[model samples]
Target: MLVLNGPDGKFVVDTFVAPAWPRLKEALDGLGNAPVKCVIDTHWHFDHTDNNTRLHAAGATVLAHENTKKRMSEPHDLPVLYRGTDGALAGLHFDPSPVEALPQQTFFDTCKLQANGESLVLQHVAPAHTDTDIHVHFENANVIQMGDLFFNWMYPYIDPSTGGKITGMIAAANKILSLAGNDTKIVAGHGPLGNKADLMEFRDMLVTSCDRVERLKSAGKSAQEVVAEKPFADLDPIWGNGIINSEQWVQVVYLTL
Candidate 1:
């Protein structure tokens, strides 16, 4: 969803859904024919990789974490996408991505790249939102693009199916906070642009939620029972406004704990 105009050609970071491809293409075209030289997928999520094939066909090399390519090459079922008639969440299935859409290059731990007159530092975090989560730090610009590790003010979708851990989420936030400065621009995978303060609040929220959920689970409470208690009722006004409600967030936190 971000484009960087390098001195030679352009570089892109993440992408939108398939329906928005033309607009993305137009945006690239408007840059006076500087072909997209590279595309980076922060994770393997479909929302971030949907336009990979198109960009690849346009002569861009796709890059991502090694696990991202592995995840994309297999089928996945996410239960958060839909609610069933039985009042339970139904699975939203994703088939393996086509070979053309898979990343052509991948790194394991960390890597650095220079583009658009900026030094980009790419670092992969431990499993938080998903196993493939990574962050791109534009050192010169003082901007950090975190795929799903920091959700700004919204409650995040923690995919337990893909090695997401609440503790890992907390650690990721702490790591970013350590790297960010007062004036740094923190780009989240969801919600509005954030700052160190916003990320601090988010990290605090996750800590509080994790503590409460862990306590309830330790007391032998069921996940549904924890949801019924609405431990996050006080914090719901901000984080709960997203697709995940307080009740649902409680469930998610419980599972991860």
Candidate 2:
């Protein structure tokens, strides 16, 4: 977990991967044991929400999009550490479970909250990365926790299984661009912090890469052919790494476009 002490209060971003109890402790520790009145998750991913129970136990109100709470409530494939019972969580786990309990505060479209004097805006851009993906904007701090919408120096994963389409990913980037300005600092679900320029580049890469895949698909090329062609030949070397490789990206774009 990473800690950012804002003017109003403290922010413990990026929790554990499996949503364990200890990870919650780590997040609290990062805040210097400060009373966390509010908790904002970039998205509903385990790494970010695994500690929700612990934070809620400490009087911290967890905030997320309505869709996020609905998804978390369902029986999905969350790991044993995060799940209440056994048997693979299955895809339905995307919704809430009895033990998980949905986020207390839910917002659709856009909503803003003020705490310790800082104003934070939460927006729903789900079905972009996943059905529940949301972006948190720290207006006063000039920083934004982009959940999975923006990944710097790494491949951005668009989970097709959860309705994550490349076109939606492009829309997410555009939404970020709309909110971000020259001096805005951006924090992705993964990777290092960056500025608006970096985000613009990231968006461009996705647009161009998806365009390449669309062209290939129109030509009636097979998925293997598209992968072999390496359509992202002119893209940054790092854009094809992590879980979303060039091949996988081609597949997603083909399905989405």
Candidate 3:
């Protein structure tokens, strides 16, 4: 999550979760008691949007890509295909968000916001982590909040059910790289803050893994077969420690393909 203190008031990039509301509220209060004028949702995922209701109630206008509003406005079950604690394939469910938690204002390609005496460029990327992903670029600050588009060192969860795709993920990373300079601070959806180099590494990992998985699938390998082969063995030690493990990452890529 990122907070921008501009001339007008405070603008938040993404809300972490519902449980983190008190801490978030405190943080906002610490900012000289500025009102939250705007709250932006990078995507429709609960992790990034759970605090919408509270923030909106506090006089903030929620902004997000149209696709995000669509997803949050309805009941949907997000897929969770991963190895269980007992080594069995497992799945999970996600209910729809409340109406109060949904975005009130949305944009298509891009939207510009003038706040705190600076310009915020919110650009909607193609279906990447989710169809609703958007990059928040603070022009004067040279900081970019990449939502879930950049997972830092981990394998990203591509929600194909909501229009996420491996190729789109690559494209989204490239889009950030194109706009970023060496000094730009990148705020990832997860993990520590990063820079251009870290973003590059993430993009490369996605491309390399996607290529390997595609090759194996082309050779008639099933998702489980591809997982058993450990196609991303070289990258696992470095990028598989986060929420998404090797097998889970392979499954997501395969299912999207």
Best by TM-score: 3
> Which is the winner by TM-score between candidate 1 and candidate 2?
1
TM-score of every candidate: 0.95, 0.82, 0.96
For lDDT, the strongest prediction is: 3
Q: By how many angstroms RMSD does model 3 differ from the true structure? A: 1.5
Using TM-score, rank the candidates from best to worst: 3, 1, 2
Full candidate order by lDDT, most accurate first: 3, 1, 2
Clashing pairs in 3: 6-116, 7-116
| Candidate 2 C-alpha lDDT tens digits along 126-232 | 48878788777778788888878888877676665556777888898898898899999888777788889988888988888788888888899977678678787
Judged by whole-model lDDT over C-alpha atoms, candidate 3 comes out at 0.88
lDDT of 2: 0.69
Model 1 global lDDT (CA atoms, 0 to 1)? 0.88
Off by over 4 Å in 2: 1-14, 19-24, 77-98
In candidate 1 the C-alpha lDDT for residue 234 amounts to: 93
